[model samples]
Target: MFKKLDFFLFGWIINWMYPEYYRPKYGYQRYYILFFHYLIPQKLFRLNPKVRWPVHFTSKVLAAENIKKGILCDPGDNNNNYIQANNGIIFGSNIELGPGVSIISSNHKGNNLREHTKGKPITIGNNVWIGANSTVLPEVSIGNNVIIGANSLVSKNIPSNSVAVGNPCRVIKPKEDYSEDLSVIIFNKKIVEKFDVFLNSNV
Candidate 1:
């Protein structure tokens, strides 16, 4: 009974504080855990969060208030993510950022090294998967259904339905069609099959 009451209370508070646009695709229990692990340290102790979404404990998100995210999409959910949304960053649905990913929207001024220039806002489209240790510089717009490979530097705009990689990050090949079905992930493995299939059940 107490467990049920606790879940219900936290669920209500979450729904009140965050609207649908600010929430992840996971359930209430995951949100509660993230609150204790990530949000508490970020908001109360460190005073670093401006959005109420679930961020990993090791991630560093700056100027989160300047970011606008879509439903079921969060950029800094992965480990060791450095998201500097000082100018602005808009994210579409189902964004997957790998470890050590840096999405910086502000650039240092050339005249004054200490000052930052307000560049264009970085906009990421739906179903995009940026690989590990990738750095997306300012004023870049990535289209939908794109995959950026590991250790790439994205300084130019990438169109939809393309697979790009490298230091300067160019479109190497076209991407295939993608499914929007729900998927499940397991620990120490990269599993992204359908959620029902993982549960041995029917959709």
Candidate 2:
């Protein structure tokens, strides 16, 4: 009975302390509220990784210093989700990480598990959506407005404005190619005229 009472009190305190958390409109934001808020044993147990406001994590994370703002991650199993950042990692704004996704920034050298191989920083650009069950390997930089399909393995750097999929994660289509059908504009006449001019200029 005391444990349940304690849990409620903890929730009340977090809700009272961070009132802005009430404004999130996404379904997954509930998961963020539940996990991050509850993960805190007390209001004073602060650590590194220096997470900015509005970021959410549904699983355990290592090397919190490497994480940036606007990252949403959910490790499906929660037990096996391992985020490794031996080098460094930079996440841009509005980046959504699907369930069971692993972003590894370093790898072990040869058969030895003690020594790690040299690797570059993993930089994920803004508006990138990594699908479920995907693994982003070391030294990879994903560009902006990219979508990686489910169960894909990102071994190489992915370019901006592309949809990549499969085991090796190949770009099947560019973002511009998918927008050819959007010919109509519903805006002010002046803005629409300017937009038309811009489109013609590109052509």
Candidate 3:
């Protein structure tokens, strides 16, 4: 009806307004929300001042201004993800947050229902992957090259090169081949090589 026509018009407008969205193969870049049922509403959320990076339409990032995230990351890619960084949060590059993951940086005070307790910022290092349905509590520091398994609850600090899982999220194994500099270089090289391949398939 009118809604379909409205989106059609908006899509055309977007194509015209933002030439930077154009690609050689795809023509004009269109995000998942554009074709999906959730359209303009999610677009508005992405433009909000509280949003630090692209978030899934169903995800919510409260107090995102308090978070310092490096490189590109979509916190809630699949859905139902929430990042509450009221206290503050620092994230290094190449961080992946699976669906239903929650990173909470503040907690409600016991004495006062409305008031929140001050906590240290959650500091996450590079190349960390927090699995689906995982919950990272306030003031937890996870070092580089860490993988928090699915449905895990991170309550304390997790050191580098660790693979952890459980209700209390403990490290079960240490990664043998993990280098911070190599990780960053590999990611960057992959991105660069991908674009090069797109431009020159023979190359």
Clashing pairs for predicted structure model 1, backbone only: none
Point out the worst 10-residue segment of candidate 2 by lDDT.
181-190
Weakest lDDT window of 10 consecutive positions for candidate 1: 194-203
Model 3, residue pairs in steric clash: none
Instruction: List, in order, the clash count of every candidate structure.
Output: 0, 2, 0
Q: Residue 190 CA error for candidate 1 (Å)?
A: 29
Query: Which candidate's lDDT is highest?
Result: 1
Model 2 C-alpha lDDT per residue in residues 74-119, reported as the tens digit of each score: 2222333456777888775446677778889888888898988876
* Predicted candidate 3 versus true structure: per-residue lDDT over 5-85, tens digit per residue: 544655555434322222221222243343342234445544323453445577777887787765434454447888888
Deviation from native of the Cα of residue 41 in model 1, angstroms: 1.2
Models ranked on lDDT: 1, 3, 2
After superposition on all CA atoms, how large is the RMSD of candidate 3?
A: 8.0
Q: In what order do the candidates fall by TM-score, top score first?
A: 1, 3, 2
User: Which of candidates 2 and 3 reaches a greater TM-score?
Assistant: 3
